[model samples]
Every structure is written in C-alpha cells, then in structure tokens.
Target: MSNLTDMEIFARVVSAGSMSAAGREMNLSPAVISKRIRRLEDKLGTRLLQRTTRQIAMTESGLGFYERVVAILASVEEAEAFVSRGSAQARGTLKVAAPTSFGRLHIAPHLGDFLSQNPDLSVSLDLDDGFVDIVGEGYDLAIRIAELSDSSLVARKLAPVHRILVASPAYIAKFGVPASIEDMAENHVCLAAANQDPWRLMGPEGVVTVRTGAPVKTNSSEVVRECLLAGVGIALRSTWDIGPELRDGRLRLILPQYRASKDVGLHAVYPSRRFLPAKVRVFIDYFAGLYGASPYWDTGLETWLGPVEEARAS
Candidate 1:
C-alpha cells in the first residue's frame, strides 16, 4: 500500500527480470506480485509493463522509474546497516592520509585515544605534503585543510580553518608591531612557507594581498611555526596550529583589522557518500565531537584578544 513497499517490490521485479522470479526471491505468490505492480501503475496513472505469453518487458516510463527505485532501495538498505552496526561495532584497517604538519601536530597526537576507543580498529596513516590519490591509493579517509577542489569524492567539514598573522613576543619587541599590511612589508621580515601562495586577507573595505620574502622558507608548516617562535619573522598561521601559542602568550596575533579569507576548512574526505563504512563514520564522528563549534585549541585565546570581528569593529 505504501509507495516505499511498492517501490521495493518493483525494483525486485526488475532486478529478477520477471514477476515470477521476484515472487520466488521475496517468497510471495506471482499473483501477489502482479496485483502490487498493477496497483502501483494505477496510482501513477500509467502502464508500467507489457506482458506477453513468453515474458514481460518494462515500458519507457517503467524503465525510468525502475532506475530510481533501485537507487532508493540501495539507500534504504545502507541506512539500515549504518544504524545496526553503529560506532561500537566498527572494525577494520582504516588507511588515512593527511598533510605532514597537520597530521603530526593534530591527528597523529590524538590517534592513540581513537585507537583505544575502537580497540578492534587499526590505522595506517600516510603523512606527506605531496598530493595523494585517495581512491587510487586505497585510502579509507583523508584529512584535507585547504580550499577543496570540485571532485566526485564526498567531503564533510570537520572544522573551520582560520589563519592569522602572528609573531613571537620577542620578535614584536625587536621589530615593533606592524600597524598595517603596507607597513609590515617595509619594516618586517615576512616568514613564509616554501609554497609561494600570496597572503590574501579580507578587511572592512576589501581584500588585501601581501607578498614578501623571508630569509628562511621551508615547505613544512612546523618549520614556519618554529621560525616564527625563534623570532625569525611574522607568518600567517592557522588557529589549530598556533592556538596554544597564542593562548599562552608565546605568540602575538597581529593586524586585527584584517582576517584571512577563511576559504579553507578541515575536511574528512572519503570515496562515496552511500554505504559509508563504520570505521570511517566513527573516525569522522570523533573529530566532530572533539572540535564541535569551538575547538579546544581556541580556548582562552578568545578572552585574551576578543573575536576578530569585534576587534575590527572597535
């Protein structure tokens, strides 16, 4: 009677290639299957099949409806499996890939707890700054922290990526706080990662671009953070990477009038949205719980300097 039941029966019939075959698969009489199909056609106000003495064939509308019904049935089954297994039942080897610096600083450190919670699960983490073929390499998950490119892979945002310019207290004392982007370029040494992407910031008026060279540049974000900590120069760093430092007064956030474009986000990328494995689902859930709306790393720092928008307004 329900459309969902009608859809499932119709899909079974198409997949089995005959009403009799569908009845056998579902343990129903052929008459019952025929009656259900007839009811479905009547509801839709269109003929769905052409029956002959030898066999039956789908009409044009039936073919289209069958395709969608098949997809719906698959989704329903996957949803059932997901809830049945849940997180506690998760078990498997989950191979993951992540950026070298972020993996080490954030992910690698927290993996012990994750593994402890899911005792049956195992993980193989690939930490590299180079591009990794997630599906080609057979990875179960990937942690990406950049502007995501359009792709077939499904992505879930785990946290927001907010980058701000920062300098060590010692560096600020030595060089004086840069009042503006233009002043920063002229008076301060600009620390940079090995990548040559220009710093793009958004202010009340519009976007501002800052380009400058450092005496030292490395491909590693950790190295960039180290250089900034050693009073090398100012560098734009993410909150996840530098939040502890900022909270502890080891690093001073500068140029409060401007905010990085916030174009990037921390994401959990996987091959498909449908039929998500319990292992991958649980791992993503762990991150969502850990980060939530306000991450642990961001604690105390907000009170110290106030939010960026408020600072800009004042």
Candidate 2:
C-alpha cells in the first residue's frame, strides 16, 4: 500500500512536470514531496529523475516505469469506476489541443455545459492550426478533422466531416448554378485553398476529380470562406463550417449529388486506447453523444442537400 502511494506520487510528479506542482496538487509541502521521491528512488535503487534548477527530466528507466505505472493507475481507476458505476465523477485537468476555427465554433461554445456537469474537473484548451505533438507536449486529447492515415495514435470518431459543393446566393445569381460537373469545368470558378485543388468527389457516376479554374487561390481557409460569402465562386466546404450560413440562407448548396468521401471525420485523438484517463473519457463521450448520427449543425440541412451518409461512430 505504501509502495502504491509512492508510485502514485511519482506518477503525479511526472504528469504535473515538477515536484512542487505535485505537492501543491496533493496538498503537501515541497520538502515532503522531495523526501518521498528520494525514498522511492532509494527503495528501487535507481535514479528516477534528473533535477536541475530550471526543470526536471525523467531518466530512461523512469520513462519506462512511468508508462507501466500509468497503465496500472488506469486499470485501478477503471476497476473502481466499474464498482462505483453511476457515482463515479471525473476530476482532473484535461489539457486538449484543437484547430483554431473549429474550437471557436464548436468546442468553446459547449464547454460551459461540460464544466457545469463536472464541477471537479478543469480544462486547458490550446487552439492552433499546426499539428501539435500530443504526447511530447502533454496534451490529454487532440481534436482533428481528417481521413486519418497515422496508425500510431488512437482516435474516436466524434462526427462526420462532409464536404459539399456550395455557393452564395449572389454568386449563383450572377454566374448561374453549375448544371453538371462538365459545366463546372467550362463555366464556373472555385474559391478554395490553392493546395486542396483539384477537388475530389464521389459523384453519381463514381469517384472523380475536378480541377476547376480557381482565379482566387490562397492558403488561408478564412480567406476562402469570406470570398465565397462575397459571391466569388463555388467552393467545396465542410458542413460544420458553413452550417449557420446554410441554415440562414446566406450560402446555398450547388451540387447536391456530389460530396467528398465518407471516411473523413472529426476525431478525438489520444495517445493510448488502453490507458485512457477518466477526464479524457468523459470529454470524448460527451462530444460523441453531442454530435451523434445527426449533429445539431447538420439539422435542417437534409431539406437542402438531401440525405447524405454519416459516420458510423460506435
């Protein structure tokens, strides 16, 4: 029992990044935290951590031990949770990384409801466009929108990301709606990020790629959205991004029969599937239920574009 307590302390120190932070979290003095770590090292007959004035780093052995200890802790927690069932309440700081626009539009809005439910837990959200190193940077989860090719990480599909061809009313009024894919080739223009062209779609015929004439090409997604809204040209966009515009009639669907593949989705990615923390589990479950089958954003959209396929998230 004493050894298990020491192991928990050691794990907390590693996760908190410092003995002082661990001490604060556990409501213990720094001296006591340091003494316990020393006692642990003495019992194991191995140096677990290398301490400097500025920071603390784990020894190679410590890293290996930490991985095992984390799994053990998760198992213990899971067992206890199974017994306690409905009474179990998640309590931890859930550090998450997410895309800038999606975080602002989707996650940030719903956080209040999550926090209200889990009073003991806290959240640390970091929004960026670049792919952040989840384990290296110590993030609990990363929300990504992609057709995941990397098998290294475990992902839970939260919602489907359906990219549909759309144009603002003004653009359609001026240039006219594209009658067919060939008509798109000859007559219409596209406003999309330069790198994403040519557009790939699953049409009535089959999988096809259309490289439309893009007079305005930019790297920024925001620029593409703004130009589309300003009646520039037709653009293929995700429903989650343009739901409000589609709902309010600011933007209308152009090619209802064509869309991107069904594999692409919004996923909650984590380092390991086996050793998931309660905080991370609850967060993922909440969003999974929130966006299940028919997401709030995609509501009333079927009337415009018809019934499109959705992700089969279990």
Runs in model 2 with CA error above 4 Å? 1-88, 212-215, 305-314
User: Cα RMSDs of all predictions?
Assistant: 10.5, 5.2
Point to the candidate with the largest TM-score.
Answer: 2
Q: Write the per-residue lDDT of candidate 2 for residues 16-66, one digit (tens) a residue.
A: 888888888999987897888899999999999998755579999897777
lDDT for each candidate structure:
0.79, 0.82
Q: What is the Cα-based lDDT of residue 292 in candidate 2?
A: 79
The regions of model 1 sitting more than 4 angstroms off are 1-88, 303-314
Model 1 over residues 1-314: C-alpha lDDT tens digits? 28899888887777677889889999999899889989999999998888765567889888767655654654565566558776236676888999887888888889999999988789999998887777445577899987898986789998877778889999998989997788997889988876735787776666777886888867777788799999999988888888888877899988866667647788988775456666788899998888866777777766533455553453
User: 248 in model 2: Cα distance from truth in Å?
Assistant: 1.9
Candidate 1 structure, TM-score to reference:
0.69
Best of the candidates, lDDT: 2
lDDT of 2: 0.82
Instruction: Report the C-alpha displacement of residue 223, candidate 2, in angstroms.
Output: 2.0
